[model samples]
Target: MANLDIKIREAELADLELILAFISEKSEFDGVPHLLEATADKLKQTLLFVESPLVRVLLAEVGDTAVGFAMFYASYSSLLAQPCLWLDDLFLQSHFRGMGVGTALLKSLARIAESTNCGRMEWTVNTGNVPGIAFYQKQGARILENIRLCRIDGDAINLLAGQ
Candidate 1:
């Protein structure tokens, strides 16, 4: 691929639709499109319009064409006594992969983590995404072994809440 001028910037309100599209595409790429239930309205309420939004998004563009996005949130590491940047999602279009757009996005995130005095940046990779794992490893991330992610939502959340 040619040397593309990849621009990474924080998402603006005008880019709401673009962000939603990227989220959908990322979900499809992860082979779990059926689990996606995010709507524009929900995103607006929970992420965009909130006074203190927990999640933030960075959009990657090659000129006028948006090629990818990275979504993340801050979490505290009690053990380290510092904040951690939890990368919730990072997705680049198939054509944009290997063109350094992903690397640029990640570099931007690392800057954010550094500026905010984060102890570390953390994310999980799906076992099936071999290429993604390799890419992350190339960026100096190590995959932790013998750790499983657990989740509870929907009815389970309600049941646990004693509803």
Candidate 2:
């Protein structure tokens, strides 16, 4: 599928709804639909209305059909003493899989990181998602065995704010 008609472009404010739909689809495909809390309004506020936006979205299309998207943000790497790019989400439609859509999205991100002088690009995959893990590995990404992801959200986040 190297000759696939995949074109990756930076998302714009007009793509809010499309991006939200893609996110929902990704959550459902990953068997976590109940965890999807994104909506067009919220996406507009955070992804478009903010003064200093925290995220950048890249959309992949094939002849006007939206196939996938990658959402990322900038971060700092203390050890490297340089900027890093954190890929929060990368997803493609089921039919688009194995057609190099994912690879194109990742490669575009790598180029963006390089252009911006980012030291590293990072993202996490679900442990049970074997295919996803394998894809990353095949792309020369190392799966760190010792590091674990932690987060606070929902009521816990509110409680922490109150304290």
lDDT of each: 0.93, 0.91
Residue 84 Cα positional deviation in candidate 2, in Å, after optimal superposition: 0.3
Candidate 1 on 1-163: residue-level lDDT in tens? Answer: 5698889999988888999999999999998899999889889987745899979999999998999999999999999999999999999999889889999999999999999999999999999999999999999998998788999999999999999
Score residue 8 of candidate 2 by CA lDDT. Answer: 97
Backbone clash pairs for candidate 2 read none
Measured by TM-score, how close is model 2 to the native structure? 0.94
For all predicted structures, in order, the TM-scores are: 0.97, 0.94
Candidate 1: lDDT of 66?
93
Instruction: Find the 10 residues in a row with the least total lDDT in model 1.
Output: 45-54
| Number of clashes found in candidate 1 | 0
Clashes of each: 0, 0
Q: What global local distance difference test value does model 1 have?
A: 0.93
lDDT against true structure, model 2: 0.91
Identify the runs in model 1 with alpha carbons over 4 angstroms from their true place: none
